[model samples]
Target: MGKYAQLVIGPAGCGKSTYCNHLYEHCQAIKRSVHVVNLDPAAEAFQYPVSLDIRDLVCLEDVMEELGLGPNGGLLYCMEYLEDNLHEWLGEELEGYGDEDYLVFDCPGQIELYNHLSVFRSFVDFLKNDGWSVCVVYCLDAHFVTDVAKFMAGALQALAAMVKLELPHVNILTKVDLMEDKNHLDEFLFPDPELLLHQLAASTGPRFRQLNRAMGGLLEEFSLVSFLPLDITDEDSIADILGQIDMAIQYGEDAEPRIRDELEDGGDDDDDDGGGDGGDDI
Candidate 1:
């Protein structure tokens, strides 16, 4: 059986950590074994227990201090450094987990990494070659649903990441519990191109009308992007999002048959033992 992993990624403050924390707790509640890996070198605190952290290999603050780079530049440098040492550090660490293990990688918020960089692409390729089913989970702030323009930008970002990675992708609207108007989410969740184009035209100048139409058409035509709303306070919401990801990666598909086989074998042994006891009684 192959292992499974989900790359939890989004912009900073999009609740990646919170999602990880809740996912970890939810998995535990359901008696599921899961491990979370923190791929963010700059992350100082976490709401969930991290099984593996990038800071142990390279620290962003130290890189910024020693190499004299800004936050974004430092994060990029840290990831690049990780890429260089994947076989030495990450590969060895992953060997500890079995084929049935499910890993959740909490990645940094740097959009550049997924947008135009080869770092995460290389990392994902490495995981695939090592016999793991990987899925990309992109999170957007739920508040973006309130504005058509903001939602479009977030959708485009998700689309870019999906195209670049070429993996089983899941998009999430995080922090739904914080939204003041839940009704605003329905339109964005099940988007209509014409409606969005009209909204965009009203929000922007006439000069950008054609561009908005084109963008809206792209979203509607491909039909590749949609978001699962995530409310950390709601267990059903979390379970629904997790269920979508599991289906994307086909997690536990192989185990079901194996479990059935084991049950059948045990039943056969029980029947044989019962026949022997009945013969002895006669």
Candidate 2:
């Protein structure tokens, strides 16, 4: 049996940490065991109690102060440092969890890590090699739907991560509750290429519209980009998103046999209790 994990990733302010926090609360409410690993070394606060934090291994602030690097550079350095120490640090910490444990890794907001960088790819490889099933949970702000160009750009970003990670991917449109007109999401969720092209033509000049057409065609050709809306205020919405993730990684598939085993043992106990002394009573 392998442990399961979802790497929560997105641009800054896309609600990645909030999603993890809400998921932690929801799992606790339902009595489902889950652990949140803070992979963002620069993260200063969290709404949920972190089970494991990369900052404990390598803090971005410390790296910046010592290396004299800026925020983004410092963060990149910290991730690389963590990558270097994966076996000695993260591997040791992960050993504490059972095979059935489900881990949610709250990743840093740097899009470069998922799109082109090898750091995250190496980290994911380590987890998979260590007998863990992992998936990418790509988060995009729901506001991206309001603009045709922005929505296409977000989709391309998701596609980039999918291509780079090559793992089970679940794209989420976060903060849907903040959108005044939820109808705007419908077009992006189930996009009509023609409609998108028309919108692009209206928004951009002719030369740029040609570029939009090519971009839209590329997206259509791949046909792998779609998003599920996530409204944190709605428990059912959160549940539906979590269900999608669970299916992506096949999280609970192994538990069915264990459940059957328990039920069989219970049946034996029932048989012993009734068959021995109460056999004639009934």
Which is the leading candidate under lDDT? 1
Encode model 2's per-residue lDDT on 247-275: one tens digit a residue. Answer: 99888787799899998778778878878
The lowest-lDDT stretch of 10 consecutive residues in candidate 2 is 273-282
Quote model 2's TM-score.
Answer: 0.92
Q: Per-candidate TM vs. native?
A: 0.93, 0.92
lDDT of 1 by residue, 133-182 (tens): 99999999998877889889999899999999999999999999998888
lDDT, candidate 1, equals 0.91
Relative to the true structure, how large is the alpha-carbon lDDT of every model?
0.91, 0.90
TM-score of candidate 1 versus the correct structure, residues matched by position: 0.93
Among these predicted structures, which one has the highest TM-score?
A: 1
